[model samples]
Target: MDRIDGGGTMSLHFGVFEVYGPQVGGTLSWPHPLSDSIDFADSQHWVDIAQIMDRTGYDFLFFADGFGYPILGDDIALGAVERGINFSGYDPAGLVPILMRETTGLGFVITANTGVDHPVQLARRFSTLDAISNGRFGWNVVTGSSQNAVAELFGHTEMVPHDVRYAIAAEYVELAKKYWEESWSDDALVADPVRGIYADRTGITRVTYDGEHYRSDGYFGAPPTRQRTPVIFQAGTSPAGRAFAATHAECVFVQATVPAHTARNVAHIREVAAEQGREDPRIMSGLTVVVAETSQEAHRLAAEFDAMQTDDVVATLYAGNTGIDLLALDPERTLHQVLEAGGPVGQMGTSNIERFLGSNGAPAPTVREIIDDLKGKGTRGFRIVGDPHKVADGIEALAAETGLDGFLIEPVFGTRDIAAFGELVLPILRERGRLADRVDGETLRERMRR
Candidate 1:
């Protein structure tokens, strides 16, 4: 099958996978002197980044968010706050309209939990956002990973099982889709001042759902936006997650450590999507790029960034991600030994461990080594440390090797690295025919599909 476009060029889409928090992806990035993390709380900070990407030819700026903080308890939570380790940020949903107004062509993807939000409210909110962005909007659907924290916040006593959360999300999305795609016909809205009728009421229908996990019955308030259902994105790599993405997500994010592994995942999702009658699920792997005018300088910058990852910060963020306490465990013990001894782990933690094992070819890594990997290139996709040419070459090679649709660039020093990438690598890619020309006023869905 031909992967290239009709022009026979490698037109790869690019987006930044962001968190609205102190750090984007790398933990404890706020304290770095070169980082623009100081203004994370300011709306202008986000606006600046969006404008930069918009001018640089990025397809979208994705905001990965959640309502629950990873840490619990006062003392540990205080420590997390003092270190600024993914502990602070505004809701990306609220920031969408503000950003869309500021940028011309850059798309905005906001992460929203299907398990927690009511289907009706979620549908309406996305519809409004899509309209406000003039179709430059997407939703990153997640099934509430921070189960304990999320459950506590929502006043639920029992934690929803991992697979069960996927089930709930499936139903939740189905109901929301009905609201987005079925509630209103193409000609529902009509500004007929002559007949004193604003909308053809006969063309509108009530949307209702009574599933095992959710219930919603309502006349959808918002009319259909440019893209009636905003582009759906999912970022889970587990079996249940892959199934969910295959079934619904228009774009998928994977954080494999190697190209071969990423290729396997991409192929699997495409196959599943094909079986489900949804062809060509767009898959993007997480990538962290560090580039400078010289290879030596880029390596020096990468090393400096690595040096800032303190043990406490690494452990704090790692524990938050996998539910495994690196500090409490014996550093010398192999990961194999820890898991074999029945280590305490949740669904996310187990998945991370398994990915680590698969990448290393064995679980012989010490707990400390594993911790270091997590702080470095563990889950973050193929790291490129070089000049602009080297970065572009690596990206092109990886795309050819893995059959990935695109990449979600992970920031090393927040906006500093993102800006650096824009200034250095983007031009090289544009010249190499790896990026498509930006079409102004195109909807997010159109840009993604193109």
Candidate 2:
């Protein structure tokens, strides 16, 4: 394959568990027993998975989170729950500590929104976790996109406007940085044995900052962790989102209906990041992988998986995400007007909605077209089905064309999908010299830089 760097050499960074926890069960909605049966409740299982991923040289296992169920017709979130969707799983954060203890070098990236917790609390929690994990921690910063969550849990009457939420997130991350980076100096942790002191108090500095959304007036309580501040990950494609990510994110997750669209967004983020003083921000796109011994078998498996995704589940998910109930709109009605009108809720403002609805004045895609697009045949980040070599080729192609740093491999099944990737695709990447060799207990930052 041709390389973007023109050196006939390339590196492929792979991450897993972007939505629900891979495509093992053939849906992203509720009643996700397929994923649950993999033993999220078992601490040993989490550790084994972490160890396996690290040994295979997988970059990280990212947990995609949501605060509340979808806001469709019923309060039940039936479409998601009944179908074993993405929302059926438990919060991955609760499992991170165990996983951290299980593996030596694997990075743990968790999604925590600025809307849910205060900066002081967030700073303390991440700092403690970083220390516990010995610097193998990253945060996927988000200003929540669930209107139902804001109203029900946070006591907000409505979700904040898109731009305004980004504004808040900017300040939120700034506060976290101040706590993580500015509060403690390298000399702070003396750990002098004869002196019977663990830390030199004088080396710790207090940070005082006044901002529109948040303010702080204290030194970080915990001592410095491996990386003072965990690496920041952001996922949003709005103009404001891009600007915010450009200023703060080290890694950005992107999703688009097609490869061209993914490439366009990658370019946009790079430009914005450069403008904000970051020369490059690692871009990771969402992808699904299905692999078998032969190309034909892969196709047959993919077809069976596609057949399992009922229209009700897909439509319900689409409606909840866009805030325009597809059930209310005529199935045959063009989504043009809805796109023009936007959503009733502020948090539902996503750039992908237009692409899904064909609001950019392109030919509107049918529900099947949308689903097929999600399957990744014509789409950018989604990887529908392929044998080991085919899957590797698709990943390499995407990175070369879009200048992306890597991909977040959303699984098609439970642990088996991830296990299959480790067994099949990883070896191909390794033979091609596109994958990293096992490192000896490196920090997350060092690993990322490598």
Candidate 3:
């Protein structure tokens, strides 16, 4: 927690932000020689990445996932499929145990939707993962995206309002806590073979809940793991989302492109956390670094990656995240005008728009301008294109300015960017004591706190 001016080594935690699908971001460089065409269906791809991250001093791997894809009118968007724009992927939670088995000292956080998954089901699932990982597991709790599409896929007639979904998530998490923390006492599992008793039945309690959005009446199926509840990770920046994260999240994720905006977000979340009688949660922002041996080489590589980005891919991803269907909107209309018209905004829509405005620097921009700007950023967040030294300086300066505890290293072109950071920048960070010393038997929560 020491700062540069404080005359102590700064220790910043780092994690890799990844998607299980082929298109990790908006970039369409899968066909390019530099890009990695990972087989989404293969577990080996994840295993390979996990080992690399584990060896490269990464604290964890965070996966962003959902069940629904972008849509055009009433059908799935063709661009989403053809362009491979964050379209398809398998559930990443299933990869946690696999990755844990494949690596040492590395943690895993997978996305789970509170809207669609039952509290009991989610609680038990995470409990199983927690046991498997020996406490190296975390949960990225989400309300889900593509509101209408997800609702239809889940067989719901109507979509839950943005704020209402958070209200429900609050209750959902409350009930899940009962299953995770209250169902079994700390000494409930007593495997005494000589006494012919596997557990202390009296210590186990049945959980009963009847909330507005969920109801449960049963004993938890899983027992306490190393950490009874997995570390809670949330990325909701809307008013309700921020409140939810302030109350429950142990680590909060943000995507404000500018350092000043990111600083404000961290301060606001800490203020809310203080108001809620909780300690400051660890806040990490999205970051994609394109680095090489020299500054010129890095910029050239970044330009090459940028050239692969297309308007259709950007718009498709924007529509998928915000549910606005940018391709259908008036190209001449400003973002403010589009918001004023009022269309479907998905769970992530509000935060995404806020980041767009912050990055664009006020003065609402036209749809065409938004698309053009998004082609470079596209919700992937702050990017640094330079050599090892510049990348290190930017990271240290950002951490000092924003008071962020961590950075989620998103990929610019598959894991190539990650490898570059590990090889070039990580050494500088380590030399400067910007990263925590690795410890054996450290849980995900413990590692992240460092």
Q: lDDT of each structure?
A: 0.81, 0.70, 0.82
Strongest candidate by lDDT:
3
TM-score, one value per model: 0.94, 0.90, 0.95
lDDT of each residue in 425-444, candidate 3, tens digit only: 98899888788788899898
Candidates ranked, most accurate by lDDT first:
3, 1, 2
Query: Following a full C-alpha superposition, what root-mean-square deviation does model 3 have from the true structure?
Result: 2.2
Residue pairs clashing in model 1 are: none
Write candidate 2's Cα lDDT for 99-162 as tens digits. Answer: 8887887898988888567798988999888888898899999887555645666677666777
Q: Please list the residue runs of candidate 1 whose C-alpha ends up more than 4 Å from where it truly belongs after superposition.
A: 1-3, 72-79, 336-346, 357-361, 377-379
Error of 3 at 405 (Å): 1.3
Q: What is the lDDT of candidate 1?
A: 0.81
lDDT of 1 at 310: 71
- TM-score between model 2 and native: 0.90
Task: Give stretches of model 3 more than 4 Å off.
Answer: 1-7, 345-348, 354-361
Worst 10 residues of 1 by lDDT: 70-79
